[model samples]
Target: MSDEDLRLSADRVLARLVGDPTDSARLREDQWRAIEALVAERRRALVVQRTGWGKSAVYFVATALLRERGSGPTVIVSPLLALMRNQVDAAARAGIRARTINSANTEEWDTIQAEVAAGEVDVLLVSPERLNNPDFRDQVLPQLAAATGLLVVDEAHCISDWGHDFRPDYRRLRTMLADLPQGVPVLATTATANARVTADVAEQLGTGEGTGRALVLRGPLDRESLRLGVLPLPDAAHRLAWLADHLDELPGSGIIYTLTVAAAEEVTAFLRQRGHTVASYTGKTENADRQQAEEDLLANRVKALVATSALGMGFDKPDLGFVVHLGSPSSPIAYYQQVGRAGRGVEHAEVLLLPGREDEAIWRYFASLAFPPEEQVRRTLDVLAASDRPVSLPALEPQVELRRSRLEIMLKVLDVDGAVRRVRGGWTATGQPWAYDAERYAWVARQRETEQQAMREYATTADCRMEFLRRQLDDEKAAPCGRCDNCAGVRFTTEVSAASLDAARGELGRPGVEVEPRRMWPTGLPAVGVDLKGRIPADEQAAPGRALGRLSDIGWGNRLRPLLAPQSPDAPVPDDVAGAVVTVLADWAKGPGGWASGAPDAPDRPVGVVTIASRTRPQLIGSLGERIATVGRLPLLGSVAYHDGEIDTRVPRTNSAQRLRALHGALTVPPPLAAALAEAGGPVLLVDDLADTGWTLAVASRLLRRSGAAGVFPLVLAVQG
Candidate 1:
């Protein structure tokens, strides 16, 4: 087709996409350039444009033109389920038959693949993780790569380690690209990519050695419709109160972003209590609930959805009038991607950031989960190499010190590098020479630190907030956005009503979270030198326990974080913390399923208090146990002693099997405690400062039960999420 004909065809498709069938809608020059590059020249291209800048239109229009020319289906590697759903619906409007095969719709995979093979589907979208699936990678991906006319990589920055949301699975795209039939066009698009990330992605998108460089079309990153601002509050309570007071006054229905899942739920509950319609959306949200919440926000049926980064990409509500962040993201690039969700279709939308003091702590915790050390990586490779058959993740987990999630990630990277291969049962060693890239990992870590420092500057800087973010992305056109808080002299007020403030305080201050007991033992314990397996006998299980609050909770978490820091000196429980602990006990005693409940099934009241001897916080846990026993008028049974203080501090945050192995036989019941339990004649209270893995509580409870206590009730100061 001639250039003019291709442009005309693309313009007609754009009209259909926007519901203007009269051909009044037309593609922008850059959009036409990309479509022409793919169709006319069969060239790979990378388009780095801001959000809502018609990146989707370029691919859909290109798909229409290519299919009309008898090309095979356009295969899109989408990141999120939400994004896939939106693109599928959008494709239908342009008369393109689009189907997705993702985790959400596994039952439809065979049908979708069949349709694509039949050339009945115009576009087929699959997640990045799907490319690494053993069956899909070995069976379906090769055939798809052969027949595919155009491959679209949405959110392409994810392929680069420097990208803020990088995933190891995305690197699998390299193999697919290398195997693609010659002259098959590819397009990679992203809304957030600095210069380094852009260069990295473009280089990777190039189909190996002989395929010349990809055409790069970079554009400005300015969103004219957004008005950015930052409103600093005294604390979490004040921040919540300010949101409760000002949410409704925002232009229209929008999102309230939180840095953590606990914060999302907390904000949602507080907003609902304040008579505002809201829902919580996080990675933990059920798929059906997330779908419903997305629909509700789109239809303006609810005021807002308090969400984490799970709702960041591919949600296309162009008229969303506001974007509010309860806590700042760790990277300015990530903050830009999230806030870009707002003001896409509207001319005026409010973007506010209420920075919290806890953001850096949360950042540090996440940073610790980065790629493991070279020693751990080598150990994992050695284990796989020694195995005769493919090792399932659960079976491999007991041998590797890495957590299951981290282990899976490491395996995916190895698979992409040819060091390992994911097979029918699980993963197998390829005996491929793989060098640990310590220097590269260290460079990425340093880059992350730089991003963190930039985010700090973003929150505290008095300059234009949008401009600061744009510059972080290496945008050359990042002139001062004249409509920001610093530029426009602060469009919002920090004053919150006294009533709202008090209500927020009450909601945050009221504490007492249920600690669900560990039911079944970790699998493959025998492999870890522990003699446990299958269901934990119900008789040996600890009863459901209570904690004053969660370390991730916005309310009590803010207070407990500093008190429990690794550097915190061991001391007696402070007066305020002790008082809160008392309040939790008061509530738990009268609540349902409590021993003091007058119900028929309630257990007998705890007869004594048994504390777990803590190597780090003995003063805190000991004093807490003494105070509880004195308050309840129960005898203080001797503490559960660790034999030779053989505690493995490294096991606290590790996988279940490793933790259980470390704790087996390490804790013992003292003879005095056994005698006291024999005399008490009723249930006893187990006091500990914290319950991170719940392993200690479970082991201690079993010992108490075997030693003659009728029941064990665990009382802890905090629970870690």
Candidate 2:
């Protein structure tokens, strides 16, 4: 029969099977037009679209239409056994005849093959690995070559090296299609692909340029309901603590992603200890265990799940409310896919990235480990090339002396290069040259390097974290999302009180203080104040007038010095100067009742205290002193009042503005240079080198107030106001 006449007869058979003489299934207009053109011209076609864009719907409806026209039986090639089962189940739901062939059906395989050869099976779904069976080619292909109506390749991106999930067996599909009878329509579908992947899909399906055809349906990449955020923390422990605090606030199904199988187990154990029913899935898990874990999550037996990235592909549960990465992935594409798993049904979802300094290092190590040496590549090629047909890894391993771990890594690399195809229990050489050019391997290596660099940059960048990620993905045009850590305006704050400063300065400037090599102390060290001279000596020095002037040249003349001592003068003061120096005063000494006492020697042990100027406002000072006195045995250092004239306010405020003036007063307090300052019972002293209107001091005092601080007192070396 002529090609046209055979095509006409096939159309009649397809119409009868699908029950739709004219397909009216809703599909993107462009895709519909492309399919119609394919059918009209009697040529093969491939369609690629983003995930959730209805690629399956297009092919399924088209299959129905073609079948209604009496087209011969159609065949579908899929990668996963579960996906094949899903397809068969879906067809059954639609009241169409469909069957699947895989390793699970040992006894039924021959019967199914015979049924397909006899045109008794309307649709047959099989894995690419199954097609490598010689019987399929010798028997099924000839029959299908004569009457095959349609061939569909789902998740066609798997055939391309550029795709996230590359499969070796997919490479042989083009050769298999070439062997099929001319004008037997081919339809390929996939959810995600970039330009390179798109080209690869077309080429692998034997639908290139003019001989065959391709149609791409683009969809919006943005997911409005998916809120993205990144959190920077000192360590994983802190991250766990943060998650613990926020877990209750984040209700609904959630997935916490970790980088390693061990981390997944660790985090899951930690969460379980905290009373959360958590399940973990990682590569180390047995298939039965993984399946059970997935089922438990789906059945709501667990509210939270901790897993490695292996849990996501082909597992569809629509209500996932959150996806959090315990560490950053190597590329934005990897992250995008993992996060995309959440909110698949278009519900509001949140994705958080909790990263630390070690995350990048771990990923780089893994990448280096995953990159196989050229020798391993050569061996993989040699073995596959020697095999007349595909050889299973189990059989090939006997010939290669490399460890299985190393061998598998090499196989994955070769699979990505399209040098060999993975068949059921074996590996097949496609007989076609590797799709990648020599430079392509270098490009992939560089791409991996770039991805690692991008991940490191994402973790370390000071800019808006989300903006950095969006830009890395070539989505720079996207606006800054306001929900991330950068947008939320959270920062670390350390408040140094006058008491802590004096204590640190006393220890650092003590005569023969016997400073430890590391300055390590059994108890924590106290905060210390530094003079304008920025030097520390055992003894008091002349007024640092000139040094203070020099400090004023910089805006930091009023800034607090954390851990520096002021320079001493040529002259020395006696060590016996008792009350002149405010030592570490006890918290009780500053409270109401303890205000009656004067500065005493350092307590044998640690005690929280603040020494205020005696000349300062008594009510304010006394109230603080009384609060300090509540520490009982810890003596309250009587409020040492300072001459109002010695104090300066950079920003002046009226007495009626108690809030502002008080805030200003606290910010200008002089600090004893120290890394950290502790507060007494109630009032905390905030010291700055210079002070303006004390807005910063006031704001900080407000923060302390929220922390149950009685009040804030300010001390400054210089005052502009």
Candidate 3:
């Protein structure tokens, strides 16, 4: 078709996409250019436009035109389930039959795949993670790639490790891109890539060596409707209180982003108590709850959805009037993408940043989960190479020191690098030569540090906040956005009501997070030389326990994180923390299921106290044990001793299997401690500075129980969520 004829057809499709046949919703010139490239030129393209710039329109219109010409379905690789849902609904409005095959709708996979095979589906939306699934990658992906007419990679920044939100699964797209049929058109798009990331993604899209390189369509990253501001508060309490006091004063219902899931729940609860309608959305939220939360927010049924990054990327609500961050994101690029959720189809929207002292701690925690070192990566490859059959992740965990999540990520990256391949049963070594990219990994780490420093500057910069963020993304047209608080004079108040502040403090100040005991042993413990498997014996199991606070909590967490940090000095518990521990114990004793609750199921009161022998924080643990024993008038039974007085430092930060293996014969109930336990005659309080993975607590509790203690009640200063 001629350009003029294509433009006329695309215009009508655009009107249908907007749900108004009578509305003259013609595609913008850039959007038209993109469609023209994909349909007329049959060329690859990268559209780096700002959010709500109608990137989706280019693809939807292209899909309609392609299907009209009897081309195969358009397969879009989206990053989030929320994004896929919005696109599916939007496609329906354009009279295109859209279907999705994601983790959430596994039951419909067969039907959806059949429909696509039969050419009954015009668009198929898939998640990036699906690209690496064993069955999907080996069985479905090739077929889809061969037949796909127009391939769209949404949020393409994820394909580059330099991108703020890189995922290993996204990089797997290279193989699919390289294998595409000749003349097949591909389009990659994102709103948060700087020059480096854009170049990297474009290079990946150029895998078809003989084909012309991807056309790059870059635009300015500025949101005129967003009125940016920063409200620096005293602490988490004040920041949360400010939200409670002034949330209604903000434009329309919108998101309030938190740095952690604990904070999300905390904020949602406090906001609801303050008479605001709110819901929490986090990675841990069930798919049904997430879908419901999105619906409620889109329909304005709830004032806001207190969310984490789980709600970011591709949640489409054009009239969203505000985007507030309770704590600043670690990168300014990330911050821009999140705030871009607001003011898409409206004249005005509020974007406020309430930076907290705890932001750095949260950032550091996430940073720690980055790709493992060269040694660990090599070890994983060696293990997989030695395996005769495909080894499942659980079976592989004992041999690898990395945690499950981290290990999965490493395997995905290796799979993409051709060192390993995920197979029917599990993963297998491909016997391919794989060299560790130490320099590249180091560069990425340094880039992360630089981004973190830039985020710090963003929070305190006196210049235009939008310009600062735009420049972070290498936007050449970045200038002072006159709508920001700094550019337009401060627009939001830092003041909050005394009652709301107190309520927030009280809510956050309340201590005690439940620490559930480990009920089952880590899989493949025997492979690590530990004689353990299946369910932990009931008699050996520790009862549900309590910690003073979560390290991720907004209130007590802020106080406990420093005290429990790995580098923190081994000092005795501070008075304020001790006092909070006492308050928690008192509340626990009188609350349901407590020893002093007077309920039928409540356990007998503690008769003694025992401490976990800490290799690093002996002073803290020893003093805490004595303090608790003295306060309860109970005997201070000696600590659980390390075997032969030797410590296993490797047990502190490892996966469950490795930790348990190192701990299997590493801890013992010495005769003195056992005798003391026998004399105590009843349950003893187990004291530790922190509980992570719960393996240490379980081992120590079992030692005490077998040594004649009636029961174990574990207590800790902090818990890792």
Q: How many clashes show up per model? A: 0, 79, 0
Q: Candidate 3: which stretches are off by over 4 Å?
A: none
Whole-model lDDT, candidate 1? 0.91
TM-score of every candidate relative to the true structure: 0.99, 0.56, 0.99
- Give candidate 1 misplaced runs (Cα > 4 Å): none
Instruction: Give residue 507's error in model 3 in angstroms.
Output: 1.2
Question: Cα RMSD for candidate 1?
Answer: 1.1
lDDT of 2 by residue, 1-721 (tens): 4445534444443344335557333345655554564455546666644344545545555566567667877788877554665567556644567888866677998788778767677788887765545677456656665677878888787777666666655665765676667666777776555557767777666643345554444443555556776677554456666665566556477788887665676567666766678888887777667768777776768877788877644555667778888877777656766776677665567778887544554555465444455665666687788768777654554345343455655565565456665656567766666533557667766777787787777666666665665454444254666655566554322223344344333322322100011111111011112111222221211111101111111112112121111232221212221111122233233433333344463212223333333222333334434443353344443332223435333232312122233333343223331112324434444323333333333344344444434444443333331
In candidate 2, which residue ranges exceed 4 Å CA deviation? 1-48, 81-89, 103-108, 114-123, 131-148, 206-210, 356-358, 369-371, 379-401, 405-438, 457-721
What C-alpha root-mean-square deviation, in Å, does candidate 2 show against the real structure? 22.5
Computed on alpha carbons, the lDDT of every model, listed in order, comes to 0.91, 0.53, 0.91
The candidate 2 region of ten consecutive residues with least summed lDDT is 512-521
